[model samples]
Target: MYEIELLINGRPFRGAAEARTTLADFLRHTLRLTGTHLGCEHGVCGACTVLVDGVSARSCLMLAVQADGAIVETVEGLAEHDGTLHPLQQAFRDAHGLQCGFCTPGMLMTLVELLRETPHPSEDEVRDAISGNICRCTGYQSIVDATLAVAGAAGTEGSEP
Candidate 1:
């Protein structure tokens, strides 16, 4: 087993995993951070998306050892410690962007990276940013609308969690 250390969601985490273990598996099984769901483990489904050093990454495609010493952000970190929702999350809820919710975490993390890079993205940009993330429900219009809503409201200033 290889020991890996990561700064996750602002907290430090350490765990041991086989060298072949995917980061998603390490996060879910070893770290007990089930928010990083696994679907289409081949990395096609974005359900396992997370932020590694502020960039969106497919956790299933990355090994735990590969992510060692990296800063990771999962869906569980999007909300405030006081139970307040992040603007994007709140917008998603208000706009009904989620249905089955399987893709919400990936969608959120992807948009988080987009907003951080482009604070006010156009509708096309929002759509492009989430193109890789597939949502079986909601038809994606709601998700685009929700991201636009957050961009409009906060200009995404200080939106980083």
Candidate 2:
């Protein structure tokens, strides 16, 4: 067993994890943070995406020990302590960006990084950023629209044809 320390959703978490434990397993089974879903464990599907050190990463592709001392953000971290939804979350709801909800968390986490890197990302850019995630429902247009809605509301919407 290896000792691991990580800051998740602004809270410091320390625990013993096996060397082979995937971050997704660590988060879900060990920490009980079930927001990070596991779809394709091979990292092909972005369902296991999370923000590690502020970049979108496939949690299933990373070992728990690899996240020692790293700052990780899960979907649980996107909302305010008082329960107010993040703008992106709200936009997703308003735009019907999710249907089955399996892919929402990963998409949200991925777009969080994208919006931070490019505050005014174009529609195509939003699509590109979320290309790694697969949502069997919603057909993706609503997700793109939701992202654009947040960008426009933030006054940082970029023009893309």
Candidate 3:
């Protein structure tokens, strides 16, 4: 067992993280923050996407110890402190970005990162941002709309095509 210290959504987490535990397993199984799902288990799927110091990355591809001392944010951590939905999450609801909800968590988390870089992403950019993520249920049109709506809500237009 390895002791790993990480800040998750501003909460300090320090404990015995099994040496073999992936960050995804640590967040979901150990921490009980199950919003980060294990889809492909490979880095390609992006289903385990989470923010490590404000950037999106595949949690399953990393060891729990690798996240030590890192600031990690999961889908559960995406809400405002006052409990209001983040604008992107609101846009997703307004635009029906989710169908099965399996990919929603990762998509939402990835959107946070994507929007930070491109507040108003064009439809194509939105698609490209989440290209690593796979959604078997929704066809992605609504997700694109949702992301675009967030960009519009933010009063910033991303790269225009």
What is candidate 1's lDDT per residue for 11-89, written digit by digit as tens? 9999999999999999999999999888899988898999999899999999999999999999999999999999899
List TM-score per model, in order.
0.95, 0.95, 0.92
| Tens-digit per-residue lDDT, 73-129, candidate 2 | 999999999999999999999999999999999999999999888887898899899
- The candidate maximizing lDDT is 2
Clashing pairs in 1: none
lDDT of model 1, residue 86: 92
How does model 3 fare in lDDT? 0.85
Reference-based TM-score, model 3: 0.92
Query: Scored by Cα lDDT, where does model 1 land?
Result: 0.92
- lDDT order, best first, reads 2, 1, 3
Misplaced by over 4 Å in model 2 are 156-161
Kindly give the stretch of ten consecutive residues in candidate 3 with the minimal lDDT sum. Answer: 152-161
Q: Which ten residues in a row have the lowest lDDT in candidate 1?
A: 152-161
C-alpha RMSD between model 1 and the true structure: 1.7
